[model samples]
Target chain A: MHELAVTREIVDVAAEKAEGARVRRVVIEIGRLTPVAPDCVRFYFEICAAGTAVEGAELEIREIAGNARCRACEASLELAGPVEGCGCGSFDLEILAGRELRLMELEVY
Target chain B: MCDHCGCSTEGHEHVHEHTHEHPHEHETSRTVRIEQDILARNNRQAEWNRGWLASRRLVALNLVGSPGSGKTTVLERTLKELDGQMNAAVIEGDQATDRDAARIRATGRPVVQIATGTGCHLDARMVKGALEKLDPQPDGLVFVENVGNLVCPALFDLGEQAKVLIASVTEGEDKPAKYPHMFAAVQVVLLNKIDLLPHVSFEMDAFLGFLRQVNPRVRVIAVSGATGAGMLEWYECIRASIH
Candidate 1:
């Protein structure tokens, strides 16, 4: 799947950040609307990280909640996933957040 | 005493204790603030490709759909109808074959075939490479037909002006609901194979309702590549877009 490619990128990024040091942990933030499974990422990370600087690194994934604002009423709301309309009966909504997939930090030794 | 990091015995509790007694002393372990997007590389390439296309005033559209959804047929039909009116090229992406490229070549259009091997989707870098090989003329239109996939292809940005979803009625009415991410990411939906409406159990009302629920602002065009029905509207849409 594409998760394999994504995981490869994560490892390369972490390894580049670590320089010559060994990475202990890698922290990542994934948004709810990104459509990537944390477990699938983890599965690929283990394989991609093998023999790299992040070989034994522990992966921590944080899910960011989806946030949106109504285009008509300008009212902000949290969504579990992509929704049809806002509570104010407005089908026009602008997504404010929850499409992020970032490598936040790396603990290295 | 803790067994993990080997700090002192006093007030260790079980967390990592990096507090040294000396003022200038430092621990070997450190946390680096990366704060980088995982898709930064791909996004950078996509931006470059976008700028390159914009400088030439060229338009690129990425077409995505499930296999057997008539994506190749749609392109073949588009090229046939828009033959002399519009100058266009095709970038065909598949897991293995260049058969689609041969088909597009038969239409007398420039074509490049990218075989991803085991990869499921085409990334921005792949498109950039293909563009260099094809080297389309200025002010021309480029159609990057992504590998037939409803899932992973939606996640990648190929530096196209917009993504068009090709769905056939035989795939069912709930495709938009089943793959909301793909539906949400596309700017237009081409409901292909409409000529089979009488034979299939597909309901137009339900399909439109589900598509609207998933993406409120997407343009939907119902067409049949085999019958050439409603293809005039498609050519008109293309003309309207580039002009």
Candidate 2:
């Protein structure tokens, strides 16, 4: 849904970077907590970039793991998703990372 | 070199000095490291909204929930409570129709509606337009009732001071764990339709226990749109958050 907006951004950014050079590939990094589907983004990207500089450019997705902090002890630790408590029995937690959605690089000719 | 055309020209057009890449140079492809945030445009718009709201002393609160979670009902009631004490405005988002906006209009408050059409969630750009149309008073509250959906809405930021997620007892007890993205993003959670507790098989204690586990700092408010049982508490919580 909102991926339409994000996919538009990817095309815009990638095309701008391409600068008539002809895009070959575009690589992106998605975070676990960002809640965006890679397949959906690719589908929209093709539609939004038709006949443009990024048309048919291969898209590669990489993952970024999330990290969290304990609200009680302030200890930062790796997080897979949502959890009930920290190691010390504190239910309070703060997620610090894995929210990233960035266009990392591009292969242009 | 100009990236746009791979040509950065300096002199007058036609009569230019001979310039070319070496014949032996082979440039098949190049990898440019962009490392730019894909949502930078949205982030900028959201930041602008935040600045605009802050300069005007407007407290923007985003309400997120499932379609049948009674978000509109809760808002209709909350606007009533803030009628005189705190001036309020509403920016309602729905897939189609101005019905929500029409409902809020009856409260005699400034209200704007965004019809997303086929879109599932409200983005910052839509919020920007709604804010311009809303023109919330300097010490007022702006309620952004997001298009009802727990998942996609969580990914988009609308420059609200905080996100308030509503879940109904009819939604059962495992919603928090099932939709962790929405539940984790908010600082407050409203368990709507508490009046239905008598008839529903919802396990309130277990739900509360799981919610706390998912977000220990999250404030949970039990509300009933039909009975208006905990509307006051909701208003108080809003006051506590903004002030």
Candidate 3:
């Protein structure tokens, strides 16, 4: 899965930042609809971090819900899963969130 | 002898043993929190590719859909129709083989194929390298046909001017609802194989309704590569977007 590739990048970034420092934790922000599995990323992170500065680092993932704004009704709604329109029967909608995959912060000493 | 604990000859021994390997093994585990975008590196490459394309005034379109959605067929037809009028190049991305690239080349257009081996989608870095190999000039059209997949390709942007989603009538109207992200990310929705509409049970109204629901502003064009039905409209849309 693409999670492997994503995990590799996370490890690279974390290892680069944690040079000469001991990594305590890694917090990642993942959107619900990003098509990336948290468990898969976590699983790959352990392998990717082997012998690196991030070895034995804890992976903390934050799942973000998908949010959208209806253009016709002007209503903002948060969706738990995939659905096209807003609750107001409006086809016009703009995605506000739940498409993110980012590393928010890291704790190292 | 230690004055603190009164252990007989143990303080020096303990201190010396601390630096050496012990007979008993202890397991140590630590936790670390790393918050970062998994696609950060890919996104950076995508941005750079976008800048490179923009500098050349090249309009790159990434065509994405499931296999047999007639993506290559649409391109073949488009190239044949736009012959001599537009300078078009194709970078065909498939899991294996250069068959699509060959098909595009048959139209006499410069084409390159990027076989992704086992990858389900084409990343931006692959596109960046393909662009260099193709060396398209400004005002030329660059069409990137992504690997035949509906899910993964929607997550990665290949530095294209627009992402076009191709869906045939045979795929059913529920495809838009089922794969919302792919439809939502696309600026143009090409409803291919309209010739089979009479044979298939595709509901035009429902399909359009669902497509609009997912992407309200996405322009929809119905065409059939087999029969050449409604192809002029599709060509005009491409022409308008490119120049």
TM-score of chain A of each: 0.93, 0.84, 0.89
What are the per-residue Cα lDDT tens digits for candidate 1 across A1-109?
A: 8989999999999999899999999999999989788889998988999999999899999999989898889999897886557887776778888988999999999
Which residue pairs does candidate 1 place in steric collision?
A: none
The candidate that achieves the highest lDDT relative to the unseen native structure: 1
For model 2, how does the per-residue alpha-carbon lDDT over B155-184 read when each residue is reduced to its tens digit?
Answer: 788999999998999999988888877888
Q: What is the alpha-carbon lDDT for the whole of candidate 2? A: 0.87
lDDT of 2 at B32: 98
Q: Candidate 1, residue B29: CA error in Å?
A: 1.5
Q: lDDT of all the models against the reference?
A: 0.91, 0.87, 0.85
Best by TM-score: 1
Model 1 superposed RMSD (Cα) = 5.0
Q: For all candidates, what are the clash counts?
A: 0, 0, 20
Q: Which segments of candidate 2 are over 4 A away from where they belong?
A: A69-77, A83-91, A94-96, B1-27
Q: What is the TM-score of chain B in candidate 3?
A: 0.85
lDDT of 1 by residue, B1-243 (tens): 556667767556565568776578655799899888999999899999999998988999999999999999999999988888878999999999899999999999999999999999999999999999999988979999999999999888888999999999999999988998898899889999999999999988999888877788999999999999888877777777787
Q: Which candidate order results from sorting by lDDT in descending order?
A: 1, 2, 3
* Fnat per model, in the order shown: 0.81, 0.96, 0.64
Residue A22 lDDT (model 3): 68
- Which number leads on DockQ? 1
